[model samples]
Target: MPNLDLWTFALNCYAREGVETACLELQSQGADVCVLICAAWLEARGVARNQERMCVLEEVAAPWRHIVVEPLRELRQAWRSPAEQDEALRELRKTLKTLELQAERSLLERLQTASREWDESADANQWLSALAPKGSCRVALETLRNAAYQTQLELAGV
Candidate 1:
């Protein structure tokens, strides 16, 4: 089973302006691949949150606070029966899924920003490249390329 501390800490990295070594360290520490994928999606989206976005994240993360992190923390501090631990683990998985969906809303917003903001000569890509791992930059480059292709298609009215 995956560790909550590891997952929570890994998720925290998403709050940063860009992906860093800390983010990769989380991956190295056996974080779930699906969570990492969602994190990458969020990173591509970049950080721009309006009131509506903030509310969405809030609503999404709120319920999980109690079920995912809080209970797990309590259990870690004061052990649980095996059956209870099983239940908690199951709950944690569900909580993570909920958080992922909530995060997707913000991610979609970020991707929208990237689509509107991407520039060939702009420093934004440079800034992201500087902060992100090479693999991440490669993926971002691919996304940018796809976005450019779509733009061309639109221009051609196809």
Candidate 2:
């Protein structure tokens, strides 16, 4: 588990039952899915949560998400209905989806690099709670947290 990367961990956690819905719910409420995934990764790795690290991660992610991911997502969402009728538009939308995913992956890599040197601590990891948006759905956040813990156990073969 020492070498577990954030992207793989995020994918696995997201693939778990209820996790996608949970993440989507959180996302719709203004939480950054990538940052939430990074939080889950850090929690699973036993990295203690603190305001300083949280700020650093947010600083690293906010601009990229606003400038790159958000525009692609907005464009794709705007095309959703039109793409249903136009084949070419559908194809273009598909490409946009792929690009959006790539952008998220790139963001995850940057988050990993930013937090790579942080040492794990015995202090309880509250990353998921700390990173989740205020007034967010508790059920969705718990779903994400449970999936992440289950993913960690699965990866550790426990």
Best-matching candidate per TM-score: 2
TM-score of 1: 0.28
Q: Which segments of candidate 1 are over 4 A away from where they belong? A: 1-84, 121-128, 133-158
Query: Each candidate's lDDT (Cα)?
Result: 0.39, 0.92
Score every model by TM-score: 0.28, 0.97
- lDDT of each residue in 1-158, candidate 2, tens digit only: 56488888988999999999999999999999999999988898788888999999999999999999999999999999999999999999999999999999999999999999888889957798889999999999889988988898887677
The sequence of per-residue lDDT tens digits that candidate 1 reaches over residues 39-156 is 2333333333234433443454445544554454455434334436588766665565566545444443433343343222322232223333445535443443343333333333
Residue pairs whose backbone atoms clash in candidate 1: none
Per-candidate clashes come to: 0, 0
